[model samples]
Target: MTARWKPNVTVAAVIERQGRYLLVEEQCPDGLRLNNPAGHLDPGESPAAGCARETLEETAHHFVPTALVGIYMARTLQPLEGQSEDVTYLRFAFTGTLGEFDASRTLDDGIVRTLWMTIEEIRASVERHRSPLLLQCVEDHAEGRRHPLELLHVDPSVAGAP
Candidate 1:
């Protein structure tokens, strides 16, 4: 039988303060790469809530996801060995206001540092991006592309205890 197909679900925070966008420099299989504060969705949480949690964990900052930036779907052109099937990603990107930084908190492992970058700078270094979604999400955020949080409905059945 063919292996069941599924896309990885992820959430990201596209946070912009002043003219620079927030990004995380992290270690990846290929090398160190830049990406928005993002990660896989946990077992039981709304996409917005997932974004908020991931942003905080990865950056040590409070992020309140106010709007959905966009839904992105991309397939991996090549799969690493030992994979059972093609891999795709369903990314829920959000635009939000960042709150107080917890300097006392430690950033997630594999996260080297968090830095702010201008759009031009981001565009110039596409080679260093962790994924294309990194730049696409930022560009969409800069273009005023946002949908109401209501667009995503989280059923109560899957709402795990906080």
Candidate 2:
């Protein structure tokens, strides 16, 4: 029997302040690329919590997710040096205010730096984005597209339910 398909699940924080959106510049397999502070949902945590953790780890800034921006799915198949397989990603995007920064903390591996960019600037640099979700999440936040955080319900059976 063929194995069941499972797309990667990730959480992202869309933090905007003073007319700019926060983004992380990370070193990808191809090269350095820009993306929202996002990462895979770790075991035993809710998506919102995961977003907050990833944002802090990547940008050194604390993030409190107030609302869900949107859920997105995308498939990719890029040629590698040898071989590669098609991959799909399911992203849960959130928008929230950024809290204090931990200046003494170090960023995660592959994270070169963190910077804020205007929507126009982000739009013009699509080629440098780690994935299309980067622009999509920013645009959605700009358009005032957001759902209540209560939209996501985690049952008690799930580990670390809060």
Candidate 3:
């Protein structure tokens, strides 16, 4: 039987304040890269919840996702020790209110630090981005492309069968 194909599902928070977007610098296999507070979605949680959780974990700030910025798909060839593999990702991007930062909380593993950058700065540092989708998501958010949260329906089954 052929193996079924599945794209890695992830969530990201497009948080902007005072004309700057929040991003994280992290250590990846390639090196340190800049990206929105994003990570793989965990089982049993809705995408918005996952975004909020990832944002808090990576940035030490509470994020309340109020709108869906966009859904994006991208593929990249990841270089392994002796081989390269193509990986596709399905990302749900969200824009929302960023609440208080917890000074007592340490950032997630591999997350070097979080910083705010303008569009110009983000565009100038394309080579340092974790994924191209990082800039696309930010541009979409800046263009005011937002969908209602109700567009994503999470059935009770998402939490698992009773």
Candidate 4:
């Protein structure tokens, strides 16, 4: 049988403060890349929770996912490592408040540093993004795109399923 196929549901944090947006510089297979603090949804957590956790892991910042900026589906043809193959992903993006930074925390592996970038700067670095959604997330956020946090409900039974 062919392997079961499913698009990866992920969350991204588009954190803006003082005219700049938060971004993380990380090492991807393609080389150094920039992106919103994001990661795959883990078991037993809501999308907001996933964004909060990923933000902390990637940037050491307390992330409060206050709004759902948008739901995004992205596909990229990327060569798999150590194999003659390609892969893709579907990302869900969110925008919210960035709280206090925790200096004691360590960033995730392959993550180098976190910085703030203005929209113009972000637009100019299109080539540095891990995927097109990087800039799209930010643009949507800048356009006042927002959804009530309650739009995503975590069914307790499904959440707790093993």
> TM-score for all predictions?
0.92, 0.95, 0.97, 0.93
Best by lDDT: 3
Judging by lDDT, tell me the better candidate of 1 and 2.
Answer: 2
Q: Write the per-residue lDDT of candidate 4 for residues 1-162, one digit (tens) a residue.
A: 899878888899998888799999999877899999999999888888899999999999998888899998877766466553444566767777788889999999999999999999999999999877999889999999999988878788757764
For 1-162, candidate 2 gives per-residue lDDT tens digits of 999999999999999989999999999877889999999999888999999999999999999999999999989865477676688999999998899999999999999999999999999999999887899999999999999999999786668545
TM for candidate 1 is 0.92
lDDT of 1 by residue, 1-101 (tens): 99887889999999998889999999976679999999999987889999999999999999999999999998754334544345688999999889999
Point out the worst 10-residue segment of candidate 3 by lDDT. 76-85
Which pairs, if any, clash in model 3?
Answer: none
After TM-score superposition, what is the CA distance of residue 76 in candidate 4 from its true location, in Å?
0.7
Model 3, 1-31: lDDT tens digits are 9999999999999999999999999998889
Give Cα distance to truth, residue 69, candidate 2, Å.
Answer: 0.5
Runs in model 1 lying further than 4 Å from the true structure? 77-86, 160-162
C-alpha root-mean-square deviation, each candidate: 2.5, 1.8, 0.9, 1.6
TM-score-based ranking = 3, 2, 4, 1
Question: What is candidate 1's local distance difference test score?
Answer: 0.91
Count of steric clashes across candidates, in order: 0, 0, 0, 0
